[model samples]
Target: MNIEDIKQRITGFSNELYPFAHALIPEELQAQQLVIDGISFLFADKDCKTRLFDLLEVTEHEFVNKEFFDLKKVSIKVIYALAKKRFTQLESGLDINQFGVFYRLGLSARAALFLKYKFGFDADEVSEILSLSRIEVMTLTHESRSHMVDFIRPVQEGLQQ
Candidate 1:
């Protein structure tokens, strides 16, 4: 499907997941605008609608649990992770592909950890929930430390609102 279609699907999924005021703009108009802007920023040359669709599909699969209804919290974490990685990559002159993979993995790992912590899961339970081996879980936990700081500090700030 096209970017507009993908965005509409995301909006529908978001609406199902959380209670929020609808945008003043018409849904399709807003979706189209978002698609256009996102493409301009992220994938200027080639069509990114398909990539966005893939990302959203993965995110939807990962976040379907009722515990993730807090979209604001999830969004803050994601933004913080992306920003942190971007800044670090700039400073270190890291390969963009590596930076992107780390950022995405960090976000997913953080979300899984948040679910485990908030939901009070045992080790076995956490492993099962995340579909990760113990070694992978440990590695993710270690790698996620800096990202967690980035992800959580903003959420704490937002809580003051």
Candidate 2:
């Protein structure tokens, strides 16, 4: 693929994962930053899916604002090498909102949900990416599904909205 094409694909895929990012951070701006930084740093040589898993695994202390790998060309590197942007606003905490509910889940559990439901990876694939056994992925998926229902359902008159 051409340089532009690959960048475009990466950006598009990153946007598709924004909701997951937002849920992970519970702040729209920080989530956007994750996507932006991810696009800037993706290695063309590395598998995109594995890179994405690495991204989610990055803790705040591990975040690198600069690009390291360009898939190879300096031209490709230049295209994605935009200045890093940071949002200084106070990020939201876990509350009753959809994002908050999602944030309450352990990071691995949340990743398991997004990997399976959002990205359509089967348990085997998720296990490989997450470094968990197949059984653990299955269990995480099951528990995450059970938790999702309460927050996802419509609020009845008698229940808390």
- The TM-score values for the models, in the order shown, are 0.28, 0.56
Candidate 2 per-residue C-alpha lDDT over 33-141 given as tens digits, one digit per residue, 9 for 90 to 100 = 6656555545543564455445444544324222112222222222222211222223233352554667667666776787688767788867765668999999998
Top candidate on TM-score is 2
| lDDT tens digits by residue: candidate 1, 1-161 | 34575455545544321211111111343334433332234333233334454454454554433322332233322333343444444434533344333344443464445444554445554455455776776666666666646644556656784
Number of backbone collisions per candidate: 0, 1
Instruction: Report, for every candidate in turn, its global Cα lDDT versus the true structure.
Output: 0.41, 0.55
Question: In candidate 1, residue 161 scores what lDDT?
Answer: 46
Best by lDDT: 2
The residue pairs found clashing in candidate 1 are none
In model 2, what lDDT does residue 145 have?
81
